[model samples]
Target: MESKILVVYYSLEGNTKLIAETISEKLSSDILEIKPKKDIDSHSKMKYLIGGKQSVIKEKPELIPYDINVENYDILFIGTPVWAWTFAPAVRSFLESTNLKNKKIALFSCNGGANGKTFENMKDKLQGNEFLGQIEFKDPLKNDREENVEKARKWAYDICKLNIK
Candidate 1:
């Protein structure tokens, strides 16, 4: 079977994007960024905090323009930051917008803490596809791009192998 992988993610502070890019590099996959339809107020830290919590509580997100054909890829390498123990609202929005039936999916999360709980939350949300596995780079690695990249690459390779693709 032929396979095409797409690395899709949302980054509040760019670390998640870096992780996605690293996965793409290791897998030679395409990349897609999920942007919010509504912009958060430039100076409002409270808005981000509130919005992120609302997103997780509601299990939804409002996404901006995404052009990916959900059916085109065989594997999806989904990356996101953990917000309120789940993916960022933008990532949730992206998942809700797309269909993943019969696809192979893996998740990667970068968080400010250990993130085991966050991964569990994400693993549940990704049920539309075969949940190959997940990788989490916790607190120390969040701002360290070089280290996270290597970690993401390894995660990507391991997932690729685990799925026997």
Candidate 2:
């Protein structure tokens, strides 16, 4: 049987969104954009200060309504921007609220610098699911746009081509 896939992501500066979109396009999967009810301005200088603090404290902010049925999809591709060396708070909120079990998960992160502990932290929080794969992109909206897109496309293809359980 063919596997169903969903790409859920939270992107403030379009970096993570680009990666998510690329992966979705590659797999022809559904996409979910995670929006926080309250969000810090990415253009503001205080964004780092505020976002970093929230990430450090592992704050799970409220998310705008998103329609999804975890049971409807067999594979999940979750993407998020690396904030404070970790995944965004909005992702935390969604993950905590959603009941995801016995699902195949693939993680992707977008960061200006290093992905740091982003994937590790997310993996720790996301237990019980079989992770198909994980990939990281650097400034998808800015640096090496074509390369990043190509990488995401190939990665998504490879993951989906794997034996689906």
Candidate 3:
């Protein structure tokens, strides 16, 4: 199969979705949106923070659709919102459902704080895949969507060239 980059993510309040779209547009790659079987109402920040853990514990992530042969992708740009200081439950589900052997996997997180442990939690979920690199944005950048996307694209290029040091 021919190689391509895949930008996969789950967005709760449109920030992450916009980031994903911008990266996809710049990279000209396929985009996949990960949706949960039961949508969590994110209107209340406190509710989203609490409900995310419950959803993870229940193992109830469901995607609206996914058809690309993930294995064929040379580089996988996995994006997610940091929930409970970790990878989003829907992203966890997507990672679990796919086998990422021999593929380069880079992570980009739209999160609320500077806690670096977010990647640690992701490491626990993606135990077997080759972790390429990670780029994270705190809550302050929600208004600077274009700038964030440029950063993500640069990060992707760095990963592809093994320049993430």
Candidate 4:
């Protein structure tokens, strides 16, 4: 039987979502978008200040209830947009709330500047699981959208080859 897979992510400005969707499509996996109950307005100029502060402080924003059952998936591809040198607060909330032990977890991040400590911080929180792979994409929505998408697709395909065999 094939290992079940899921791509979970939170995108504030469509950067992370572009990569997440690409990976999900390539792997033929279910995708979950993490939506905070109270989300920051992307249109606001203060969004960087607000989102960065939340991420820096490690705040767990309340999430809109998602119907995904994580236990059903054997491999999880968690993606995030970098904020304050870390993953988004909504992704933080999901990691803390979900039961992810022993799962084959892979990570991906999209950032305008750098992934910073996003992978390290996520791995620290996601202890006790086997990491299949991890990848970082820079500005998937702008810099090179098609290239980034193709990278995500190829990365996801390679990860499955390593894990699903």
Candidate 5:
């Protein structure tokens, strides 16, 4: 039986989007981009302050319009950027809103250097789901784009193989 897969992610600096897009293409899965109701300023230092505060507090930001039906997808590849050593507030919101029980989840994150508890946080938020695996990219945007894409492709392939079994 063919599995229905979806790549859902929230990106502030486009690094996570790049990884999500690569994985979506590899899996031939539909993709959804999660957006906050209020936009965060990517260019401002205040963005870090607010994001860090929210992440540390585990605040869930309200999401904007999104139409993906999570129930249709059997496998969800969720991606987010690491902020304050955890997943972004937008991702937190998504997890809080979505019903993921019995779904197979694979997590991925884009980070500058430290990933401190990102995967752990995601797992904590998403209970009662089968976690396939997780992958992390270190400063993918500031580093080599080609290398990052290659890594994402390989990771996606590996995840797909595991899910198939």
Candidate 6:
């Protein structure tokens, strides 16, 4: 059986977006990019400080209009950039607005170092869902691109093979 899949993500510096696009291509799924009503500063030294503070406080930044209905998809693949050892605040905002009860979810993150608490934080916020899988890519833009693409392809295939239903 073919499951309906949606790839939703928030990207800063374009790393997470690249990974999300690859996964969406591999799975031939619909993709949505989460954008904040107010864009976060990516070029400032205080970017980490501000992002980390919002994530720690669980602040849900207002998101721009996104057309895809969460209820229409069977499997949701959420991607985010690792900020302050956690998923970005924009992702938190997206999670807060959408209902994922009883849905199958797969997570992915792009980080410079460790995945940190990205997956853990997402699991915490997204309760009552069947978690299918999680994958992390380290510095895909600055580091090995070909290898990360292969890894993302394999991960997407594995997600398709999951017996979530």
Top candidate on TM-score is: 4
- Per-residue C-alpha lDDT of model 3 across residues 69-100, encoded as one tens digit per residue: 88877777888787766777787778778877
Whole-model lDDT per candidate? 0.74, 0.89, 0.73, 0.92, 0.91, 0.88
Clashes of each: 0, 0, 1, 0, 0, 0
Clashes of 4: 0
Clashing pairs in 5: none
Better of 2 and 4 by lDDT: 4
By summed lDDT, which 10 consecutive residues of candidate 5 come out lowest? 156-165
- Cα error, residue 128 of model 3, in Å, equals 3.5
Model 5 Cα lDDT, one tens digit per residue, 67-148: 7798888899999999999999999889988888999999999999899999998999888999998999987878999899
What is candidate 6's local distance difference test score?
A: 0.88
Candidate 1 Cα deviation (angstroms), residue 127: 2.1
**True-structure RMSD, every candidate:** 2.5, 1.2, 3.2, 0.8, 1.2, 1.6
Summarize candidate 2's per-residue lDDT along 64-106 as a digit string, tens digits.
8877776689999999999999999999998888878888999
Q: Is candidate 1 or candidate 6 better by lDDT?
A: 6
What tens digits encode model 4's per-residue C-alpha lDDT throughout 1-165? 989999999999998888888989998899999999999999999999999999988999999998889889999999999999999999999999988899999999988887789999999999999998889988877788788888889989998998884
Q: How do the predictions measure up, each by TM-score?
A: 0.84, 0.95, 0.82, 0.97, 0.96, 0.93
Error of 2 at 155 (Å): 0.3
lDDT score, candidate 2, position 96: 89
Higher-scoring candidate on lDDT, 4 or 5: 4
Greater TM-score among 2 and 3 belongs to: 2
Cα displacement (Å) at residue 57, model 1: 3.0
- Residue pairs with backbone atoms closer than 3 Å in model 2 (clashes): none
| Tens digit per residue, CA lDDT, model 1, 1-165 | 758888888876667777887888888888988877775563686966776666557646567776778679988888877776667777767766766788888888888774646667666666766888888776424466677677777878988876644
User: What is the per-residue lDDT of model 6 for residues 6-72, given as tens digits with 9 covering 90 to 100?
Assistant: 9999997998889899999998889999999997778999887888898788788999998889878
- The reply for model 2, stretches above 4 Å from the true place, is none
